[model samples]
Target: MKFFPINKEEMNKLGWKECDFIFVTGDAYVDHPSFGHAVITRLLESLGFKVGVIPQPNWRTIDDFTKLGKPRVAFLVSSGNIDSMVNHYTVNKKRRNTDVYSPGGKAGLRPDRADIVYCNKIREAYKDVPIILGGIEASLRRFAHYDYWDDKVRNSILVDSNANLLVFGMGEKQIIEIANLIAFGKNILDLKDIRGTCYITKDIEGLKDYIEMPSFEEVKSDKLQYNLAFKIQYQEQDAIKGKTLVQKHGNLYIVQNPPAFPLSQEELDFVYSLPYIRTYHPIYKKDGGIPALKEVEFSITSHRGCYGGCSFCAIHFHQGRVIQNRSKKSIIDEAVKLTTLPNFKGYIHDVGGPTANFRNPSCKMQIEHGVCKNRQCMHPTPCPNLEVNHDEYLDILQEIRKLPRVKKVFIRSGIRYDYLIYDKNTKFFEELVKHHISGQLKVAPEHVNDEVLFCMGKPSKKVYERFEKKYHELNKKLNLKQYLVPYLMSSHPGSDLSAAVELAEYIRDLGYNPEQVQDFYPTPGSLSTTIYYTGVNPITGKKVYVPKDPEEKKMQRALLQYRDPKNYELVYKALVKSGRTDLIGYSKKCLIAPKKIRR
Candidate 1:
């Protein structure tokens, strides 16, 4: 038996190879951590199955499928993400809170492809390949969901991706079970017993009956119900298994597995323990661009998850609200490994995570008091979950810098200014400047408008200004060239022309013309997107402004990168039309005005 990975180029190059299984996908890029396809493919190879990876296949026609030949066992279908449509829509809809992807420029593409289109392409390509859909897109969209883009709920991707099976959440365990069952010669029909997967069928009435029986919605919405559901799903303790629902319709068999096991502390440890050979994009190989691997720097994960529940963000949904951390020793060892790499540079570290400055568990105290109710501490408001301590991080920083090969350490991740400002001592700040490799630190203030910032779960503009002032004062006293380069977002919900102009004014006052400005893309499963669709805060239930017009969105986005004269003219007209003349001559405000008038 052999395996085939079906993508256009690979299919053409290795046409019609006899294989036991085929893996099909639609991602041009590879080595993404979240996409377990790469690992699963490697694991199959290790098991002695002839496996092939089709990277970024054109799903436009059936010709693309015929090229891969046929497989003996099954065709594993994944689009890297759970559902391309969900990924595309959510990413496209998120407002540009930062200009990180600016170098790519405006490609003028839809944020995401709808699932129906992807499913149609799959149905056209491989009529009988036993398609299996898994990933965040498939997981969340497995059932009806609130679609922010369309402003209504939509059907599951299982109905759309045309796959034989849909696996949700982290696919490691489910994929492994799938491969093992196939290896044992159990047909897809006989393997519905496995947990942690969902499949589709024509028996819509049965499925509806099964779902309506107890209403997972009731269990899913309330915290206590959600936790009990999560425990039932993860723990899989037989005592909790209330009932099993099996629905069969026409050649399709839909099996919804009991939730798989949660990652125990040991399991979580194993995940981080995997040999993470971080590599740079081959495009950056020439200049030794991956600074950490080159020995010039080391990359460290400070913490994970963000408390700021931005509606368009997937981090909370995927990584969860609770922050998990590595022991200081684990981080220090990674730093030690950097020194051993060939042609090592003297830089000890560049530390960061989803949000740097967040160290340890955010709710240690809450756990101690046994009062922690929510998974996320920072949400709603910073909880008394854990002691907010920068010292643990500070100690790790100090330790890594002491290494002989380490000349300096840097914090490259965008610092949460609000968190840092709360630190009582300026020792961390002082050490940061004294040990700088680059004369700059990057931060994301996102937006200056109070309404926008509040919506983003960020500190007010005043807080960021205070941090900025302190940052500059420290740099001056230390006689360092290091400066704070802030990131800003544009065209988010609640940000009208006036709000955008206010942000532009703030940017100009900072004396920087950022080349990139991000327009918001609403990712699925974010609180922000929920608010975007409802025009009211999901948490607060207050009426809010959401810019619905395309022209208005474009003008708001232009406020960030108003270097081009055409953009300036358009923005100027927009601002004038909106009657925000008070922002016209402010240097920051001038981003949308003609250059000469500002001068």
Candidate 2:
């Protein structure tokens, strides 16, 4: 099989030979480590399968697929990121409030349909070729999920995409198995024995013996229960074992694999150990205008998973609540290699992860005793089980910064403000600013309302505000312009008009107009969506206001970006309508109001 670069020259040099299979994916941001699609492609090549990568495929038409010709086996589909839902809004109201997934012009379409549309187009062009969907988007959406766009729950993507198989979770082992099985002439339907993959189905009659499907109520009410049900249905061979569930949907058998093995520390280390051949933008191939490639400055992750179980987050659910890290030495080696690249400019040196500050397992001592709980150690509140020390990570960052080519090491990932404050490791914060920041630090205070914040399992907004003030004060004292860029989310389940108005007022009081505002997107498989659907806190069993009305949610989102006259008018009216006129024209409220109207 022959390989083709997205560029023409590389395609010509590869001799224009046809490949056995083509891998199409939405993740083309090559430098990212998490997607690891590039590595997977390389691995597939090493195994003697001729494969071509269609990174960020043109979802608009079938022409791209026709050019590649049909493969003997199947095409692999992934969103690059763990899931597509995370990047998009499922509700129409939420979609309007934020520009998460704008339709791509000819090249870009809706993200959800981008893959499905592209895949179907390929099928239309080549009817006999097998198509397979995998990655986070397919995996999580393989079952019915709460669609924020529709403001209601929807069925699996497997049903919508019409792909042969849906691979879920970390798909390294499963992908290899799929390639081998298809190579050996096994039909897609016959490969159901293989674990960690989900397939479409219509009938759940006989398969009930092997898999137990949870009621919609159970799944909607408890995230852990939903996860546990999923775990039982999709168990793999080596790690946790799960059985496939066959549910009926109009004469088809929808097969879903359980969550696969949580990558062991050794496995996690090995993945990071692979050489990162950071490639320049494919468009930069012909032009001499391409930025530095040799001294390429790219972000590398230090760890994955988050133990801080913020109710609105999905990192803990999808990646697991446990903190997984790359060895400090391994991280440093990557950093050193990055420094050697000629294109490396002195910019941001991001040491990112789900939660970068969380380097090692939260509870090191408990591991020795084999006493570990899968849930967040600091649930309900901070727990003693939390391994709060970041000294090791701090040392690693320091060493990375000391590398010859490195100028600045910034932590672009969201900092756990609560964790830092709780750790009382103020010195680390000081060092973080002195060394890592590149003019700004990003922190997520999601919402300012205490009730809303409490529902999010976050510390008080006052706490974060205090941290922000202190950070600014420190920067001022040091004569540095560095400042905190707080991330705020609007229209979360518990956020009322008053709560959102409060947050807008707070933003105004801060004397800053944020460059961006995040409208809460209720992705499939997240705890937040569960709350959004059920209108009750999954953990607390407390009643919560999850506004289903599109207009109300839109107004709530507008409050965050209150500079728009329409938004300000809507929020102001909402405040007055709610009988909270006390907040109307408050100094903070006026911050987001139009300049002429502010009084």
lDDT of every predicted structure (CA atoms): 0.58, 0.65
lDDT of 1 by residue, 1-599 (tens): 12233444544565545666666554422332334555455555556666655444445555655555666666665555434554343344554332111112222122244334444565676576566666566665555445656655454566555667777655656777887787787777556656667766544453332322212344334333323333332222111232344333234444465544433344444444544344433443453342223321256654554555555566554444445566776677777877886746777446766677776556545223322333335533455533556777888889988987888787776566767776778788777667743877878878999889878776677888898899889888988877677777877778888898777767667777787776776655555665565667645557778887888888887877666665877677777877876656756444443347353
Give candidate 1 misplaced runs (Cα > 4 Å): 1-22, 28-35, 42-51, 60-74, 81-130, 145-154, 177-197, 201-265, 272-304, 326-351, 365-376, 398-409, 425-427, 561-565, 583-599
In model 1, what is the error at residue 162, expressed in angstroms?
A: 1.9
Best by lDDT: 2
Instruction: Please report, as a residue range, the 10-residue window in candidate 2 with the lowest summed lDDT.
Output: 98-107
Under the 3 Å rule for N, CA and C atoms, how many clashes does model 2 have? 32
Question: What global local distance difference test value does model 2 have?
Answer: 0.65
- Predicted candidate 2 versus true structure: per-residue lDDT over 336-371, tens digit per residue: 766776667855457868787887766765334322
Tell me how far the alpha carbon of residue 336 in candidate 2 is from the true structure, in angstroms, after superposition.
2.1
For candidate 2, what is the TM-score? 0.80
The local distance difference test score of model 1 is 0.58
